[model samples]
Target: MKLTVVGGGSTYTPELIDGFARLRDTLPVEELVLVDPATERLELVGGLARRILARQDHPARVVTTADLDAGVADADAVLLQLRVGGQAARNEDETWPLECGCVGQETTGAGGLAKALRTVPVVLDIAERVRRANPDAWIIDFTNPVGIVTRALLKAGHRAVGLCNVAIGFQRRFAGLLGVDPSEVHLDHVGLNHLTWETGVRLGGPEGEDVLPKLLAEHGGPLAETLHLPRAVLDRLGVVPSYYLRYYYAHDEVVRELRTKPSRAAEVAQMERELLRMYADPALDEKPELLARRGGAYYSEAAVDLAAGLLGGGGSTYQVVNTYNNGTLPFLPDDAVVEVQAAVGPQGASPLPVRPVDPLYAGLIANVTAYEDLALDAALRGGRERVFRALLAHPLIGQFEYAETLTDRLIAHNREHLAWA
Candidate 1:
């Protein structure tokens, strides 16, 4: 088995490499390629990846390349984790939207739309190159604005599946709380990427008894605190919202908080500098402790599971993934890419039928899905009107005045990345 990582220079690569080392039995990788345009960072990361494999005594060979086609040629799977513009650009994404009184984030709201515009095209081009080299290869996208990027890939007729660590992160957290194996806990995770709710937590499988109420009854306060939501809200909703929902539930408060603190991108940029320095060290054979704080918690496990299920032919095994709705949610269009529990196999992922959704969650999901549609349109078609329409559609930026201001900010901050700007 061969796997390619498109943005191997990212500080997150070590976490992925650590997973590849530990979960080699599951993925059974023979040749691993690290593809990146940043030669210096790639060399450091590649050296560390080799050291990681060597430390584990894994037989898989680590190769680094700046050539996308050569790196992906004949690969079994290609994982997309590239940031079109580095952290400096991300800092801009996270700061500009705040000027419009919207929560500036990399994967939601106006900033998210900006990222989608920049990311979708680059990811699609990479997908096209991967298809040209190996038509059968599966594309596992871990890019920001995953819903849009995955939808773009799927729409372009690529064999792609979107992977996010949110479900796995929740599973591990709930398992720790329940004193059970992570795999033994299954979540009724619903909604689109970065916008979801855990309506039910079951044991063993989808049909297992629901323990979500029990968890809330016992650990509601801690759970709510972790999500930065009020405990009363969780008790009232009888569900756990992903942390991203905080942007919606407390938009103004979050914008105020963001105004006071440094952008997440700035913090990450500092972390990357330290991590790259560590990666350049010959003695560092394992993933550094600092990498854990860099985030993408459990990303490697999620990627391994998806890749193993796809390449290893693990059929009908359920995993939470981002894929076509295909009527999984009766309220959503079939082509809408949603994040939910799905059975994984050689055929790719197909979401399981979702139980009926409460109007509270359904209303928001529908709203965001519509915004995503416009976001994708702007990402692909590229126009100020589309950007304005998407911002207007976004629940967090619904005012026409806010939309207009954000559209200009989005274009100005991203002129170099946007073709039609």
Candidate 2:
């Protein structure tokens, strides 16, 4: 099987390719294709792939090209990590609207919606190419507005999975903080990609049943120490969620509670700074900068690592991913693409549809759908007015009267930018 990675030019390209290289010995796929509009990064990624497979004498060929078709043709799996418009464009998405107190972010607030508008077309175009070349290959996406893009692919009737390092990574971290062995922890998680919850955590030992309940009553426990969140979700769920989930839940809750909206740039910048600095300290003396860089605050799925577990390692592996709901949660409506637990094996993935989320969790899920729908709308139609209204519905938007004021300002403020279509 030939595997292809789109946006092979990303900074994370080397790690992802190397991560998958380990899988060459096990999985059926043999060829590697690295595709990117940027020829140089594509070559660099392909070169790295060649180097990794050098000793194995594998059939792998790290072909690099600008032609979209060559990248996806005859592939068994395709991974997309596109930064569609690049950082400069994303920065504009953040800074332009903040002038009016209505911050725009790439995947959450109006800013994210704007970026979605620009990205959706490009993603769809790539998917269409994959459809003609490798119809059955699973499209593993690592793009912002993951839910929005995954939904679009489903709407077009393509097979794919939205993978995020955030959900599973958080589950294991929470387990570690809770002092339970990672092998024994079973997580029942739900919500959108960045926004999710560990609704349940059951340890393996006989005392495991009571561990979650006790943590709930205690309000804050040792497990809470690992979380960097706004509401203490596990505290609210009666347990602690992964520290990464804190990113979305904090934003989700602030919009729910105080009704004040903070700028998304401030959120990303603050967290990025903290994470970057944390890894930058003394660890540098031992490992080379490249390996340290990924461990250090860079969000990556270690796609190859996950592939190993899901392929045939024997232990049950499951993760909540951005995929069409397919009625897993009865109340969610199959159309809503939610991240939920799914069992994986060699044949492929089978999402577990247990029951509807509680009314409270349902409410949170609904809020995410609203935003995702708006992003899809803006993305496909390029309607700035839709973006403005989406902002008006945001939990963060209604909290402040200035939101409508800012909306009007944004309409006028971004007249040209909004009128691009």
Candidate 3:
């Protein structure tokens, strides 16, 4: 099996290689191509893979290339980890948007659409290359705004899968909170990437309404106390939510309990800075096993293995992933791809086709989905109008004037970054 990483220059590349290498004992893919625009960065990952090979019982030859086509051609599996605007630009992307009172979260809402606007062109270019070079290769995209980006890929007619590690980490958190082994928890979650909810989680068996609420009562614990979300949402809404759900509701109610702008803005900004520091610190790299540890922290093995298996053998595996919505939910627009588990394989991804959600909450979420759609439209079509729509329609942005002001400021602030369509 030939496996390639399109953006092997990323900080996460080593850990991803570690993922493939660790799975080598089980899945046994033969060749790995580390491709990046920067030769030096690709070499860095190649060196790490080589070191792992030197230590291993079986060492696969690792190739580093600056050429994307060379790396992707004739490959069986491809993992994309590219940062199109780079981390610095991403920081600006969030900050500028937040100054507009746009909530400024990555890979969700209008921010996600803005991210896709600049990124989709590049990603679609890669997809084109994959089509020309290795038509059969399954592209496992790890890019942000996964659902939105994947929609572009699908619109372009490529074989790819959208993946987010949020589900894996949350499931493990549920495991820890519930006092059950992580492996023992049967789970189901659905919604767009980042902002999703655990529809159901049970100890053993599936398909009982009684089982669902009981599991939440036991397993939804304080997002393991690190995140203010799952706990806060559970406390108020009577249900645990995906971690990023905090951005959806009023921040004042969740953590600092402040409803106004400046204070909430300050608190949110501090949160971003704090999180970015954890990632940007070079000293942390000296720890040797941070990526490997983090990969485990997310419980990525199940999802990773599922894709590898699907590619190799074509057995159907159920997994929650971001993809184009072709009527997966009864009321959700056919164009909006909400995240949900599905039976997947060589043909492509298909949504599991869940029933219409309960009336009270689903309508509210559909409104959120509308914002996501506007986000996608704004990014892909590249207009001030769609941007205004996304902000104006957002669940968080609230009032009309605030949304318009935000739209104006964010568009002006990120002008150089935006497509200017």
Candidate 4:
């Protein structure tokens, strides 16, 4: 099967390449295309990708190109991992929101809205071209603001599923702590992308015995530490919240912390520079250890599993993915995209039934879903008013003054990317 990675130039590509090399038997990739507008980074990543595959004795032909249409043409699947405005824009996304005393994050609050606005249109255009190239091809989005982007793709009628490393990362972590293989550990992961909770940790399958309480009872300290939350919070909730939730559970504290530290974008930019230098080494045949610090932990594994499942290859029958709710959560609209454990196959993902959500989480999920609706609207039909409204709707930036200021800062920093601006 053929596969295409639209942002193959990204520093994250090597991790993905490593997975494709190791999991060849699962996905059985024949041709792999790396599509990117940045020719220099593309070549560096592409060379490393080839060397990694060759060292592993994988026979997939690796191709690199700047032409999106040509790169995706006739591919069996296309994976979207592009950052529309690069790290510089991300720096702005992460910095400007802090000025409003809000969490400065790439996929939450004002920063997330900015990312959604800049990303959705570009992703849509790529999806449209991919649709034209191979109507049967599946689109796997690993881009930030995945819920909004995936919603755009699906609403436009593209064959798509959204993948995030959060669930897989949690699976691997829980397995390590439980002294079991990752596959044997199943997470009752639910909620929207980047805003999810592990309600239960089952062993064997979806119906397997729930061992979440056991995990919390024994491993709550480390788990809470990883999430940057207090152990008491986990014990109180009886569920492990994704690290991203720290932004919500401790908004003011997070904003204060963000203000003191350098933006994640800046740190990543420095890391990418070092990573690119490393990628250029002809002797480097494996993904560098530094890439792990660059984030997207276990992204390669998640991508491989999702792609394999979507293409009807050997893959996990149930995985956490972002897809239409379709009433999986009675509180969310049917069309709203949510991240949850689902049965995945060539027919697409069907979310498994979820237990009744506690009002604590359900209220937040519903609030964010509404904000995402406005974010998508501003992304699709850009306007100052739309941007302001979306910002105001966000739980993190509900005040009009902050929303107004953030809207201007977002548009000002991103005017070149926003056509309407």
- When 3 and 4 are scored with lDDT, the better candidate is 4
Rank by TM-score, highest first.
4, 1, 3, 2
Better candidate number, 2 or 4, judged by lDDT: 4
lDDT of every predicted structure (CA atoms): 0.93, 0.61, 0.65, 0.94
lDDT of 1: 0.93
lDDT of 4 by residue, 304-356 (tens): 99999999999899999999999999988999999999999999999999989
Q: After superposition, how far is residue 419 of candidate 4 from its true place, in Å?
A: 0.8
Best lDDT goes to which candidate? 4
Angstrom error of the Cα, residue 333, model 2: value is: 2.5
C-alpha RMSD values across all candidates = 1.0, 5.8, 4.7, 0.7
Return the number of clashes found in candidate 4: 0
Candidate 1, 52-121: lDDT as tens digits: 9999999999999999989999999999999989898889989999887889899999889989999998
TM-score of each: 0.99, 0.77, 0.82, 0.99
Which residue pairs collide, candidate 3? 252-257, 252-258, 325-337
Count clashing pairs, candidate 2: 6
* Candidate 3 lDDT by residue in tens digits, 1-421: 7888887765566555555556665457678788888675566556666665555554677888988888888988787777766655555555555554455655654455557667777888898998899788788778877777777777677887788877777667667766777555645677777767666776653343324566556654744255565464575565556667766665435323322344333444454344334444433322144454323244236445656655755332556677777877767878676777666666667777575566655776688787766776777677887788887887777677876777676666557667574
**In terms of TM-score, which candidate is stronger, 1 or 3?**
1
Clashing pairs in 1: none
Off by over 4 Å in 1: 313-316
